[model samples]
Target: MNAATMRAVQVVRAGAPFAVTQLPVPEPGPGAVRIKVHACGVCGGENLARLGLLGVQLPRVPGHEIAGTVDAAGPGVTVWKPGDRVGVGWHGGSCFVCDSCRTGDFVNCADRRIVGLHYDGGYAEYVVAPQDALARIPAALSFEEAGPLMCAGITTFNALRNCGARPGDTVAVQGVGGLGHLAVQFADRMGFRTVAVNRGRDKEAIARQLGADEYIDSTEDKSPGEVLGRLGGAAAVISTVGSSPAQADIVQGLSPNGRLVVIATDHEPIPLGPELLVFGRRVVAGWYSGHAKDSEEAMAFAALKGVRPMVETRPLEDAEAAFQNLGAARFRTVLTL
Candidate 1:
């Protein structure tokens, strides 16, 4: 198979709709591999792209949570062989000579490329990526089931796990949306007492059903912060809500030494009263998607705990529509080739 030609979804302009066009498949460069994409998950990042919020260069594919198989390999790409199942996430490729890469902190690399944003992504029949960003998917995992973890999964997993979550800690996930729902499950399975904090009576049932031991309805009775305070305050607040308004309401709920892990949106400044941080000793931190350390661990944990996203699949041609659906607060959407 020459595999010289393949199809992909291209974003030609920001703020306008995306189009599915057939483009020549990119050959893997040195330390890279070409993958035949079986599935790619739509993400909040695409939502940002569609709205021009991310401000990425126009006309780019917009998917990072990718799952597929290696069809070809570039020179020096020895970790993967042809036909091997694999995945690529948001941290598409990094400059190895950078200080961050030298320190094994590829996520903070000065010259990092993001799939779909910085380069063409997996929203197609085939995509190519640096071997360092690739993780071998488990044999038992299906492409659809494993796709979301590449971005969404690894993001939440890294945020919490790296933040020092321990068994039996009170982990409150404010906003039971896409990331919140997954965080609840991850925390529950990881032995934390999970709390789902949302602003309505609507999410209570579903939140608990998704393994949240506690639900705080911010819309009624008390604000989520007050509710969290009543529960003795959270040991850690993993905020999946992107908006500052949402985060502003819950920031005060963190206990002394507790952390607020915010990852939903960029440029949304989270405001905290200086006294609160000084008195309560709470910390507010933001996390990007993932590095190899966390992504690799996330896959192993997903396989170990059966933590797959509650995904809705759309055809590759419908990627733009899928982006709309995802933006409308629709849960998980995976684009299948």
Candidate 2:
């Protein structure tokens, strides 16, 4: 195609197939930067645009785990310039005057913009994003490695770091999938006694290789909570799966005053009892993907600690197939342009 036009995969309607169309290369508005997208990870979060959840408009490019270099910067944008490597995650931008932003919680801003949902995202050759939404990718990370780190990496890393579990605490990572796999590594590097809980023994070897100190098979007659209780209970459980029953079942595994941090998204309500929380002062909290600074920190930590996500790369043209098999991917799937 010409320089002015670029290939983009867009969801034309709710639950419709992704349409590969030629669109004019978007120019950066004031305080924005246009990126030459090198890689974008296909995440379940794309369902927001694919299914039109959260009232997303039609004909929207769906991708938030973006990694690339700045091609151009708009007027009034000084922090980022052309050729600087950067990545953008779910938190696109926030209204600076909002109460949440004023309190330094941009992720919870009254008017928080989400990448891919608010505008065209990195499911294309070019994506324009707000200046403040850019996260500097460390030199050690490739575009493919940095893409998933923007969302999956940040969500797991940020949540584990802020989950109030101290070093040496028993931290169990539920589901050794996309987020769980990374969470296992982060938990180990963070000095926690990491536990990997999954369906069977099939992933035990890999989990241990990823630094999990222990493995619990959920399919066994003994529940995950019971297994953890035998090991002195877990200081925290990071639930990376969207199964509500599984989340509730793991609650009994928490030590007194233990916390359960849920990062996976599901509409079903967790059937938790008052007794469970009242007896041990346990807490069930949810963590959203972090802001730009958080993403940078997560990437830096991953680079320093030699933590990386196992990803399968596909050509940009295969975005539909990649997204369709997202859940079945070994861990993460990235679309390379």
Candidate 3:
């Protein structure tokens, strides 16, 4: 591919694998910035696009966790210029005129455009993004590391920090996968008494090393929630697992007035009994990837606290394999350009 065109892996249709193809390099429209993508993280939900579950347009590039440098700027793009290091996440861009945006709650903007879903994303050598969607990448964080932080890191970090849990309070992070790993680190370093909850002993050591004060392996025929309660009820339980059972397994374990913050995107209905909520005053809520400024704060905090995701790198040509190995792999996948 020349400077005029770039290589990208596009999903031609639902249930089909990504096809490596060449396309003309996209130009930034008004208020946009073109990034020379250095790295893009492969998220589990990207598979939804392959399955046509995300309602994305066909023959599209799918990726939301992106990190790179700006190479060009569009008209009226004053905040960012060429050579600026940046990353973009799921909350791509919001309509500034929307009520949510007007109130500075861009995360809930009714007209939000989801990257890789509403528009082309950084699953290519180059991707153009709206200026407002870009998060400044910290120099201390590598492009590969910053890539996942845009989505996985920001989602986990942003949720935990804002979930009403205080330092020294017990916080349980369910699942030891992509999002949970970062959640564990943030909870630990942020001064919370961290508990890592997951099935199997394989990730126990890793979780503890990542700052978990306690590791709960749920395979021993004990409810993770009950176990958490036994160790002094958790003030907050962040469910990062995609399984419905895994999420249900922790609802009853929260401390009185405890909050359950869910960051996973599982479509299955979460079983919630009214009794559990009324009896303990427990509440459950879901948080999506935050706005670009929120992502910037997350990146800075991760850098300052030395919290980083366990990541595995793959060549862009191995995009299909990387996407296939998402959940089972010990570390999140990052595609290097």
Candidate 4:
């Protein structure tokens, strides 16, 4: 490989095969930092680039769950320095003068910059990002482990913490796959009575071992809502699956004032009756991945509490195959550079 160029996998065209190409190393601009990416997680959210669903430009390096080290700090950048371990997620940067940023709600910024969507991302040997988009990686966490935590980890962790469920309250994580697995762990560690809900009993034992107080198979005669209702109803249900009907089926399981947090990206409208929400004050809300500080906190919590993601690793060269098989991965797939 040429010293001036880096090998990266890019979506040369929307809805086309990923192309491995050599590109010149990028320099961080003012207020930005260049990262030597050690690992990048292949996430379902990459569809935004793969399918061009978010107006992502062609020939884009697509990845947001990035874990790396600062290799260069651009002009005017001070908080980050070379050799610092860091991670970057979906929330790349925000216009500080925007109303959302002024109020400290950068995630909701009107002109939020998404890492992979708005600019070149971490599917390469190096990536340049705004300083505010970087999160410190805990010493106890490896690059591969920290990569997924930037996206999946922070999403579930932040969602569960903000779902308004108190300690000892019933909190259920729907689906035991990629995001669901992490949600179960976070819910368990957060002091809630964690319940793992899935389609079959295949993952029941794993769920229990992951700290779920109970497991519910949706295929059983009783619906998940029925089972959760029998168990006193869930104070919050974190729906990690992308099926709207499945999410809708779990609403009746929420206790009075219970919240259903949707983290998965599903465009299908969730059908619901007015009585279902009006009578119980139930809420269905969507949660976007959090900011860099939130990612830092999630990593620190995981490092301190032994919360880890079950991941499959592949070399950066195999990103094409890895991304193609992401749906079948154990939980998360990390691309090692």
1-337: candidate 1 lDDT, tens digit per residue:
4655677787776667888787777887888898999999988676555555555776777788899999889999878898898899988878989998899888999999888877778888988888888988887678997788888888888888866668998899988877888888888888999999887778789889888999988777556787787898888888887678667767677778888888785466666667767887778888888865567678888888877678889899888778777856546899998
lDDT of 2 by residue, 152-214 (tens): 999999999989899989999999999999999999999999999999899999999999999
TM-score leaderboard ranking: 2, 4, 3, 1
**Residue-level lDDT for 282 in candidate 2:** 94
Residue pairs with clashing backbones, model 2:
none
- Backbone clashes for every candidate come to 2, 0, 0, 0
Alpha-carbon shift of residue 88 in model 3 (angstroms): 0.7
Which runs in model 1 stand beyond 4 Å of their true positions?
47-58
Off by over 4 Å in 4: none
What shift in Å separates residue 301 of candidate 1 from its native position after superposition? 0.4
C-alpha lDDT of all candidate models, in order: 0.81, 0.94, 0.89, 0.93
lDDT of 3 at 177: 88
Runs of candidate 2 with Cα error greater than 4 angstroms are none
Write the number of the candidate with greater lDDT, choosing between 1 and 2: 2
Best-fitting candidate, measured by lDDT?
A: 2
| Residue pairs with backbone overlap in model 1 | 11-59, 12-59
* Weakest lDDT window of 10 consecutive positions for candidate 3: 47-56
What lDDT score is found at residue 291 in candidate 2?
A: 96
Query: Cα deviation of 146 in candidate 4 (Å)?
Result: 0.3
Give candidate 1's root-mean-square deviation (CA, Å): 1.9
Candidate rank order under lDDT = 2, 4, 3, 1
Which residue pairs in model 4 clash with each other? none
